[model samples]
Target: MNILEVNNLNKYFRQPTEFHVLKDLNFNVEKGKLTSITGKSGSGKSTLLYLLSTMDTDFDGSINISENEIKGKDNNWLANFRNEHIGFIFQFHFLLPEFSVFDNVMLPALKLGKLSKEEIENNAFELLCLLDVADQGKKKASLLSGGEQQRVAIARALINQPTLIIGDEPTGNLDSQNTAIVLDLFKELCKEKGQTILTVTHDEDFADRSDRIIHLKDGRIVT
Candidate 1:
């Protein structure tokens, strides 16, 4: 089944002129699949991601995530929906520098308030363990090495058990060993937990290894 569906998507930037960034895009992301979006610079890969993640409402299209249309929702509605249904990881870990690794992972679930505090704590620790960073949970997020920090970030993203995980060059900053760790983690999420992932990446090997790659050029899918 499709966890995400996009149809007739179009995005434009206005200022100098009405320049279109994404044009008539259409796609579906299958549940339990790891999909990558690949493109050259200015090909609207990131722009398309922003729209799919419901961060940019200025675009024209129908985007249905988890079977609900997100086109007309307000920021407040979108924010709440996103917190519950979508998880995000960026090139930078984006963990709070001063927060402990455990706290950083628990923040989203704490805000969600769907689970008991004890349950959230258990899940947070479990995720950290799953990500192989349980030992670092007590330290400040900034104190860990880059790979450790990224693992913590992934743990944070999974704490909420989002319907879909979206990543923007999640391994962009990592060394080869760390990159392999993350790539393996993504595969594990899909095969073991039946999670769906959609990531935008410049890493050719990463794209090639994914279940599928959506290649874009001139704001349109060329492959």
Candidate 2:
């Protein structure tokens, strides 16, 4: 089944001048699959990801995820929908420095309020274990190494078990070893939990290993 669909997407930037960034893009990402969006630096790959994640709403066309049409939705509605259905991992691990690793991971679930505090804590611990950061749970997020911090970010992303995990250069800051770990983890999530992932990456090996690679050029899919 398709977890995401983008149809006739067009975006523009009118700041300096009217410049078209994305042009009539369309695609579908299947459930339980890992997909990558790749392109040259100016090809709008990241813009596409922002749109797919429902964080940018100034584009034209329809974006449907898990049967919900996200285009035209208000920011409040989009924010809530995103919390319930989408997990995001950015290039920078945006953890609260003052919070413990466990607390950072549990924040989303806490905001969600769908589970008891105890249950959320348990879930957070399990996610930490899955990411191989179980021992860091009691440490301050700022105290962890770069790779460990990224793993903790991944754990936090999974805390809510979002139907789709969207990543923007998720391994950008990691060393080769940690990058491999994250790539493997993404594959595992798709295989074991039927999770859908859509990531924008410049890492060729990362894009090549995904189930599908949507290559863009000059704001259009070239493949």
> What tens digits encode model 1's per-residue C-alpha lDDT throughout 114-215?
999999999998998899899998999989999999999998889899999999999999998999999999999999999999999999999999998999
State in Å the error of residue 174, model 2: 1.0
- Candidate 2 C-alpha lDDT tens digits along 24-125: 999999999999999999999988988888888898999999999998899999999989899999899999999999999999999999999999999998
Candidate 2 lDDT score relative to the true structure: 0.93
Clashes (backbone N, CA, C under 3 Å), per candidate, total 0, 0
Compute the lDDT of residue 143 as modeled in candidate 1. 99
Report how far residue 116 has shifted in candidate 1, in Å.
Answer: 1.3
lDDT of each: 0.94, 0.93
